[model samples]
Target: MALYITDECINCDVCEPECPNGAISQGEEYYRIDPNLCTECVGHFNTSQCVEVCPVDCILPDPDHRETKDQLQRKYLALSGQATAV
Candidate 1:
């Protein structure tokens, strides 16, 4: 599944550089993750890097954009143009 940043985010900019997929970006007040670009770091890392770097623990699973492990890998590949979209 992809991740979402909560409103509680302190906008400390800690999680932006940790994202392997480049899904994280500066939002109006808090950081945001593009679901289409988020792969939960399945192909690049063992766990979500954003979550690990978030100081306020604002990053959480995006229930509305849930996808399987295989799907997440596919998303990563697709974003990088290494595989077809699933």
Candidate 2:
């Protein structure tokens, strides 16, 4: 599933740099995650870097954009332009 930043985000600017795919960006109110670019870090790392570093614990999965691990892996592969065993 793609992750999103809630209103609780303090805009501490921590999560933006953590995203491997550059999915997170500054929004009008808070940081936003582009679902199209977000792969939850499947192809980049075992864990989502933004989630790991978020001190407010505001990053959460987007139910509306739910995707399986394989789907996420494929998305990551496409975004990264590299092949790897999932």
lDDT by candidate, in order shown: 0.90, 0.94
Model 1 error, position 55 (Å):
1.2
Runs off by more than 4 Å, candidate 1: 84-86
Over 1-86, each residue of candidate 2 has an lDDT whose tens digit, in order, gives 99999999999999999899999999999999999999999988999999999999999999989999999998988888886766
Per residue, candidate 1 scores C-alpha lDDT tens digits across 1-86 of: 88999999999988989987789999988889999889999889998988988878989999999999999988888787799545
Candidate 2 residue 71 C-alpha distance from true site, Å: 0.2
**Candidate 1, 36: how far from true, in Å?**
0.6
Off by over 4 Å in 2: 83-86
Residue 81 error for model 1, in Å?
Answer: 2.0
Clashing pairs in 1: none
**C-alpha RMSD between model 2 and the true structure:** 2.7
Backbone N/Cα/C clashes per model: 0, 0
